[model samples]
Target: MKSRYILAALLATATVMPVASFAQQSAPAPAAANPASQIPAADKQAIQNFNLTDDVFNRIVKVSQEAKAQGIKPKDAKTDFSKIHSLDDLAKQVTDSDPRIAPLIKKYGFTPREFLLANLAVTNAAIASEAKGNPRMAAYVDQSKVNQKNVAFYEAHKGQINALMNEEPDPAAK
Candidate 1:
């Protein structure tokens, strides 16, 4: 069986994990189930390339809330998606602990340490911005932006990062 299929089966058996954004969040496998009894080819590639699971998406949703609390106006973020790295990292920043995130550590094959560093770097940018008027805050802000940018660089290449997840390298890449 393919890795994607294998991951889907395990998630379907687990039940709590649902593919929320891709399909209506109801139950497991509904996302994969027949809207047409066949998935469109573009969507198939998109789902695989998206490199994120529904559970992860749900967790990432919290980042918007976090952004609000940090005083980053929607316009501020929208004009510069660079502020959040990419759509995926934008979602990843505010994630709290979810039980489903555990099995996904293996299945998704994410580099947790790297991801956490990236997540925190972005969060700290907001934190640093608050300090800009204060000299102490300025120092921290400079440091935070540096951290955020460093992590963002990695995040900026999410397509490449995603290429590594829940998938095997194509023979041609070799």
Candidate 2:
């Protein structure tokens, strides 16, 4: 029962964290009227390389939308995602604490860390590109630098991360 609460809280945190961070920064410009053209080529390639399938990415967007509708806030205002060194840190903490999370993440073909890292990379790239024309969005450009570093870290350790995820018992095996 306690674990369920923890999982809920973590999921909630995951949903709201980015929104809260963006809120602290300036409001983003309206997205390009054409959605398909919005993602830059480099960002698209990064998403593909990370294997963040449409289903996985859509689910993440859905969670963010829900969080916004509910006006959720971060559990801790001081939590700075820029400081996260690697996806491994996120994956281990979440999966180790709640076995249930591992399977859900696996369903999306991601470790928890991979999911977060990929999403952050894609999001930051889009925001940074948009910020390029707007002086007010300078902070997003800085945030994007942090995200790019983390994504590079993930790419460097991709094989090891996949091996670690594979070591976990498949949910179906149970």
Candidate 3:
């Protein structure tokens, strides 16, 4: 999978872990039974306007890893894996579902909303940096508005982030 898709999948799995597990333990259901919620206007703006701060970026990364370590698994066969429009959808679902994952986000000092925004911002910046000279990918994500500092941070931390992404999902998450 592309790195972008991998990152997105990782985030989605983390957010859906608790809910998916519950749904599985309860009864069998259609995969797409749970539809994605509409993202509020305020959240849409927050996601668009967000510029990643180093602290927020660090917290997001740390909280993601901690969540996995604490047994929050990625998408399993039981997961709906429904298509979501943006990080806003993931954030709303995670926060609204009252999942255990929400507390981990808060433990790192980010509301689910804030963490999603930072996630999008940092992901965008990283994608933009990689797309700088590549025409096809560049056309997909706007490279101009990405924060330079965020891009620089992504460049500096690229190895660490890649390593994390490539790590096997913690079995305890099951």
Top candidate by lDDT = 3
Q: CA shift at 98, candidate 1, in angstroms?
A: 4.8
Q: Write the per-residue lDDT of candidate 1 for residues 62-116, one digit (tens) a residue.
A: 3322322332221211222233322334334322223334344434444433233
* True lDDT of residue 134, candidate 1: 65
List the candidate 1 regions with Cα displacement exceeding 4 Å: 1-98, 105-109, 139-145, 148-174
**Runs in model 3 lying further than 4 Å from the true structure:** 1-45, 76-89, 96-98, 170-174
Q: What is the Cα-based TM-score of model 2?
A: 0.36
Model 1 scores what on Cα lDDT? 0.32
| RMSD over all Cα atoms, model 3 | 9.9
Please list the C-alpha lDDT of all candidates, in the order they appear.
0.32, 0.43, 0.56
Per-candidate TM-scores read 0.25, 0.36, 0.63
Clashing pairs in 2: none
RMSD of each: 19.9, 14.6, 9.9
Q: Which ten residues in a row have the lowest lDDT in candidate 1?
A: 12-21
